[model samples]
Target: MSRHGRVLVAMSGGVDSSVAAGLLHEAGYDVVGVTMKTWDYETSLGGSGVSRATSGCCSLDDMNDARAVAVRLGASHTVVDIRAEFGDWVIDRFQADYLAGRTPNPCVLCNTHIKWAALLKRADALGCEHIATGHYARVREHGGRHVVSRGLDAAKDQSYVLWGVAQDHLARTLFPLGGLEKTEIRRLAAEMGFDHVADKKDSYEICFVPNDDYRGFLARRAPAVADLAGGPFVHSETGEVVGRHDGYPFYTVGQRKLGIALGEPAYVVRIEPETNTVVVGPRSALAERTLTASGVVWGKWAGIDGEARLGGRIRHRDPGAPAVVRQLGDDALEAVFETPRTAVAPGQAAVFYDGDDVVAGGWIDRPARAQPEASPEFVALPTL
Candidate 1:
């Protein structure tokens, strides 16, 4: 029997995951590497004449690379087909969110709903005690709860995207690269004789979207979007139709390049899908002090009793700002920032943090148009 029991590691044919599996195997754990086939590159080309070389993840080459790594370590590897699940949940939601004029983070949704959930099911079937990944975040038991915290590498910290991992899944999950930096992982991969994956480039684009062109992907997925094109870009402050955009779905909140010159700088402040209107305004108009979020997933605590001051992130790249969060209902809450956060995009994940540990997170539903006055006391904020 292995010293640490059987562990199922998600190998994505990347340096991080490969190194993670290597480390686990070297530590005397019965490691099983699995590469999930989430999408097919040929059909995902969207008739854009894009080649398979431009594809990011879940490719045939990736699967073969993962198998090679497993063979090198004398471990077992399996490729599971998850294209149907991914399409029904992640891809469908991606297309639907664009049609609804909301910028959806497909990676976040995949991780929360499909990726971990699927991995857990596969692990159970394989008699594995735990499932591991290459994500740069730490999970530990804290205060009788499984808490996720930021990785040591701030530049590569992925805790923002991992807030939706439920407490139960987190208990049986592991992040081997959480304590190590990217450079260390690369170096370790080289030291372990996996030269092919030691310097593999990280794939940033969405798996199914070729060349990071989400606008084109949406256009191809939903042909009806063509009719929504040529919509009016109304000014947020003056309520005047300043320009016209190809489509509201193609634009996201805080997008600056409108392809039309307005004599001054302008950004998308809001998108009204009901009217097929894209609201544009000066940069100042993009600042939002408060936002309402639904589908709350509590992490550190079951629920927030009252108001708790925490750092709230509106998007993945956001550094987060000081905010006081208050639970409004069973699965809804409002966040009042100490200072205004720019481009509070609806349909994006709003993750809250207490120090480095994730407190809870939810999908942003609405952001208040008026910037409420910032005060030292949280009770002074107005109701939604």
Candidate 2:
């Protein structure tokens, strides 16, 4: 047997995965390329929004693209049907979050449940020792334990959405293309005569919803959203009625383009699903000092000792900001910033970091009742 383990590369029918599969093959690993037919984009009726539940995997074009690359790379390719699994684990949860008026990250959910979860199963069935993907992230084993790290290129690093991945999964995962940058990957692919992938533009918008109209996509996928429409939009500071919107869930915090123009430039300050109100405000009100997080995964908080200070990044693109993190209870953490950070949104997640090591982190709680920063010393969460 070769030193390289049998690797199962999860081909998403894209240039990234195509290069990853080829690299693994060149490294002398017995490789199998697997493209999951997670959802049928054709049946969903052409790029409609509601990317989570309605239809998925972009379209037949994506699947065919993956198949062509796998054959060219001299690897056995298989399409594993996972429609039912995606619906249960991914789609249903996506619709559920939107209806509840939270801006859920479906790709994070897919990485958590479907890609790593489902593909890992196929790897076991094929007796493959590891599974690989085109994700721009890397894993390294240090001191007898596996650790996750950013890819070679900062622009392509996808470590944020992968926080929930298990240490064992990292140990058994291969990221062949991670050591290279995007330009290098494309250049290498073209050199190998992979025609379509050479000029392929990476898809940044929601894949299944090609049109990118999420509200209409939701209405078409789940009519429940449309039923909860025609609510009042309010000014955040004054709580004065500003305009009417179809739904609060349709908008995300920190978004400025979609708002109805007021006399001054106003940002989305808050979203109240129960009251069906979307609050807008001037930019100043958007700054926040402390954000509450729950669902703490104690296992992933490796480097932290007791109380530790760290930087936190709520969104993917953020450079992260300095914050003092303290455990409130067995499962809750409080993050207070040295200075307020702007455009922090509630319904999204706030992932914390202690340097490069992941200290405990979780979902961002809705804005808490404001007490003066000096009004009182903060208290730990009351234990049950």
Candidate 3:
């Protein structure tokens, strides 16, 4: 029914992507399924061990499932090797962020740089007019500008990680699973006779990091992280050395499992990577009213000037809070929350929203710092 001639779909060997490919093909689009080989478990682990399960993306088993689904749909499928790109863009950035005492979300990087950017290029080379994925998000064109919106299924919405996607690609991108819920997708897959992946479990762990043990992965991949001398945990308020830690790279901001028994519960307030030290404080000290972020990507509103009232989410699961966002410089913005938020960690994405639509987003540059209350003139408007 649609006008698209040839479409390239990124099949992750999961029920969602398989169903997406099927739906697109049934709708009269020439679908070509492509699975990206991001990492090899044996090579990443240096052959020390093999993964117990093959449920995650990029695994040998996932590729096979993807191929099978493509065959069933009567579509062509190919495996693209992206291991080198994944290592440099995702793995290296993850290790370096931790080494610099910041927690990094490799999934966000992978989705923005690898999944969409790299695949879009390949789609063009293969004479495909559009590239589709299984992400639970929606894209719409309003007033001739492409906008990214949250999926109809709130619980399964994946728009948070997709805010960094470039605006130009939005027109050429398709999210076939955006309007449907996970339950409905599974039901459709079953009806379509995709029983092999219909009941498959979703992967939550990082694909390259086996067993979800990031600490161990970093120790093996980047041994220099261990050579850094241990430092003392300094109390933020009292300014006294309370305990010692193995190394600063092993910890993250807002972490509570320091292994040191301070009489009162303390959380990591900030990490000083330059001095290899961690600042700890009581729970109350974690509240923050303001945060500065960099790498600002204005998804729909690209060139608006001055200040704007918006809802800011520091993490993916966060419900979001009212804030006034003001542009600080070319690639930076400062957001002051109406009410203080807790555990606003650095190196995490801070996405802004105008109702259900994603307005803009950026990476948190540092741990949340204390700031005075917002001025009355900059208060955010109430959400409808």
Candidate 4:
């Protein structure tokens, strides 16, 4: 019998997860480690057009490492193959979003729809009270609702990707590394005699697309989209076709290299699949003051009361910017940034935060060049 109760810990064979599992075990919890195999290395092709094994989280080596760590912790380990689910929910959405001329954040979708959903189901089957992972974010009860907050490690805070996690799932989820920094996690792993695990580098690429070449991956997966090659690259400011691009689907907003020499520096400002047009212009063209988002899931508050003062992070690496978010509908909201933000891509997530705590998040429908609609009830609040 354990003091805290049984916990199902997700171990990815990395130092953070390994240390997380060890910490839970040391804290007198009955830890059952699970290594989720979301992709197959033998079938997935790298950017080199070869099916080769790699050392990422999805590889067999990672599963083996996770099992070894579980054994050392005296915890039972299981390898769950969720590749089918992963492909259906994550991979298909990724390709579909790109084909629709939007930039999708697959990591957010995977963490919210696939990983947590799978873990909760597994935890229920295993008679575990809680499910845990190595994500660097904190979950707590605020105002009678579960809210996710930024981690202690600002550099590695993963709260941006966790915005879409449903409230019920957030209530049952636990992040063991929420309060610790990466250096501390590595030190803990080293002290546990897992020096190799401590030294392992973090995996940044998509699990299925190991080469970090998304353009190549798209071409290989949907060969028909290859026909979209030789699309026109139009200038956003001036109504002129500057050059031709390999394909509109292969390009994402904010990409600098257009493969064509434009006299001045250029960036991809927008993508239009309807006409197979890739809009390019100066960096100034990417700036947008208003953003409309859909598929919103509220965290800190059930919904925005009138206009809420918050900060919006358009991408994972964004430092965040002050914004006023207003609920447009049940599942949609509009955010107007105090200062125009550059590269506000559609299909990417726009996560709103109240200080360090997540307020709500949604997929950006589009960044509006126009200002917010004038209404009698709309009153501008002080900057967040």
**TM-score leaderboard ranking:** 1, 4, 3, 2
List the candidate numbers ranked by lDDT, top first.
Answer: 1, 4, 3, 2
Per-residue lDDT tens digits for candidate 3, residues 1-384, read 345689999998999999999899888899999999887666566633556354255678888889999999888999998877887778878887887677788888888777787788789989899999999999998777788899988888889999888878888999999999999999989988899999988887788887677777888887787776568899889889988887888887678978776687889988887788888988888898889888788777774499889989998888889999998777688899999999887888999988878888888875456322121121221121
Best model number under TM-score: 1
Cα lDDT tens digits for candidate 4, 206-303:
87875787887788788898788888999888869989888888888899977766677899988888789998988888889999988899999899
How many collisions between residues are there in candidate 4? Answer: 0
Assess candidate 3 and give its lDDT: 0.82
Clashing pairs in 3: none
lDDT per residue, candidate 1, 1-384, as tens digits?
899999999999989999999999999999999999888665689586777755777667777888999999999999988887888778888887777778788888888888998899999999999999999999999889999999999889999899788889999999999999999999999999889989889988888998898878877778788998889999888899987889888999899978766678899988887788998988988988999888788888788998999999998878888999999898889999999999998778999999999999988887898322211111121111
User: Given candidate 3, what's the lDDT at residue 174?
Assistant: 92
Candidate 1 wrongly placed segments (more than 4 Å) = 370-384
The Cα RMSD of model 2 versus the native structure comes to 5.9
Q: How many clashing residue pairs appear in each of the predictions shown?
A: 0, 0, 0, 0
Question: In model 3, what is the error at residue 205, expressed in angstroms?
Answer: 1.3
Assess each prediction's global lDDT (C-alpha) against the native: 0.86, 0.71, 0.82, 0.86
List all candidate RMSDs to the true structure: 6.2, 5.9, 6.5, 6.2
> TM-score for every candidate vs. truth?
0.95, 0.88, 0.92, 0.94
Superposition-based RMSD of candidate 1 using all C-alpha atoms, in angstroms? 6.2
